[model samples]
Target: MTRHTLSVKSLRTTMADRRAARRSRQSLERQLASYTSESDRIELDAILSRHSGAEANELRSIINRQAMDRLIRTGA
Candidate 1:
């Protein structure tokens, strides 16, 4: 390919990758918005820090369940 064509293709690929990343971040933000409590949000951040591979939805569900379990155990 010509140098000009190669540059154009490279720019297009970079832009597409950036757009995909932005969309992924927006989706994650929406999922995280489900956790309205401060403690749950803090727990989520801790969980995310420790479990880097976990998705927001899955981790949120786990944190919510764990919080519920704690509440039940304490009878509060």
Candidate 2:
């Protein structure tokens, strides 16, 4: 409709997308934590803790990949 209304709608959509991404990231982190040992989980949490914004998501993806790789190699 109006320009202002369109801008508001876009902002709301962007916020929703960010929230959904955050939830997905959290779920992935939880799954990764479950797959690792306590010491490794602590290290993973430390790595996962130091990042925020876009880098946080990227770091989480990297951690997930690494965990999967370890599991594959270990056959665990």
Candidate 3:
């Protein structure tokens, strides 16, 4: 393929990846909202805003685990 064609393909892939990540983040935020208090959600958002890269991923993983635990405990 030509260089221009390759660049366009890479750009498209990057955009798709970003959109998918945004959807996943929104889904997780919605899940947290369903069970968390407003104050707690605000705090969580603050923490997220301060972190990036692996730290953010770890926080999200922890949040997802805790959410799952709550669901299981509540029989929901």
Candidate 4:
């Protein structure tokens, strides 16, 4: 492939990745909002805003685990 074609392909992949990430983040935020109190949601949003990349991923993982635990306990 030509250099220009390669660059275009890379850009398209990057854009798609970003869109997927955004959707995932929004879904996680909605899950948190549904499960957390208003104060806790606010605090969580603040923490998310302060972190990005791997730190953010770790936070999301922790939140997901807690959410799963709650669901299991409630049989939901």
Candidate 5:
């Protein structure tokens, strides 16, 4: 597989992992109900948000590079 393929696969996995973590955190929040402290929820949200954002940026970079490659190959 191309390195690009590997990167996209990795990005997909990272996104999946981020989804699972956020879901788990949300479930925890629901379970806590009136018992949840604000700090704990904020921490969980922050962690997931950072990871998801980084993965998205990486994917965007990869996609842009691929697009540029196509343009150059076509002499455009």
Candidate 6:
């Protein structure tokens, strides 16, 4: 049997786990602008999932959903 001891070193528990990035108001607008077509919209939505844990996500969801509803109703 062999036993070994290592020297003490600085370590961070969170260094390996990546935190989801927080999006700013301007960043959200830029993201919105990137969507031009239905395919683009789907891609944008996939990318959006990363930073949507914040309070603003609900607001944007409500607003965009309403806009989509209006467009469908108007048939335009």
Report lDDT per candidate: 0.74, 0.79, 0.78, 0.77, 0.62, 0.55
Q: Give one digit per residue, the lDDT tens place, for model 5 in 1-76.
A: 9999999999999999999988985675445443234475465446555666765554445444555665688897
| Model 4: colliding residue pairs | none
* TM-score winner: 1
Worst 10 residues of 3 by lDDT: 29-38
lDDT string, candidate 2, 1-76, tens digits: 9999999999999999999999997887666656467587678778779877887777677676777888899998
- After TM-score superposition, the amount by which residue 19's alpha carbon in candidate 1 deviates from its true location, in angstroms, is 0.4
RMSD of each: 10.0, 8.7, 9.2, 9.2, 17.5, 11.7
Candidate 6 C-alpha lDDT tens digits along 23-75: 35456555665555778666656666666575547645744775587688889
Q: Name the TM-score of candidate 6.
A: 0.36
Query: Over 4 Å off in model 6, which ranges?
Result: 1-34, 55-76
Off by over 4 Å in 2: 38-76
**In terms of lDDT, which candidate is strongest?**
2
In candidate 5, which residue pairs clash?
Answer: none
lDDT (0-100) at residue 67 of candidate 5?
Answer: 51
In Å, residue 9's CA in model 3 sits off its true spot by 0.1
TM-score on alpha carbons, each prediction:
0.58, 0.51, 0.51, 0.50, 0.45, 0.36
How well is each residue in 1-76 modelled by candidate 4, as lDDT tens digits? Answer: 9999999999999999999998997786666646565477568768887888986876777676776777798997
Model with the higher TM-score, candidate 3 or 5: 3
Error of 4 at 32 (Å): 0.3
Which pairs, if any, clash in model 2?
A: none
Clash pairs, candidate 1, are none
| Candidate closer to the true structure by TM-score (higher is better), 1 or 3 | 1
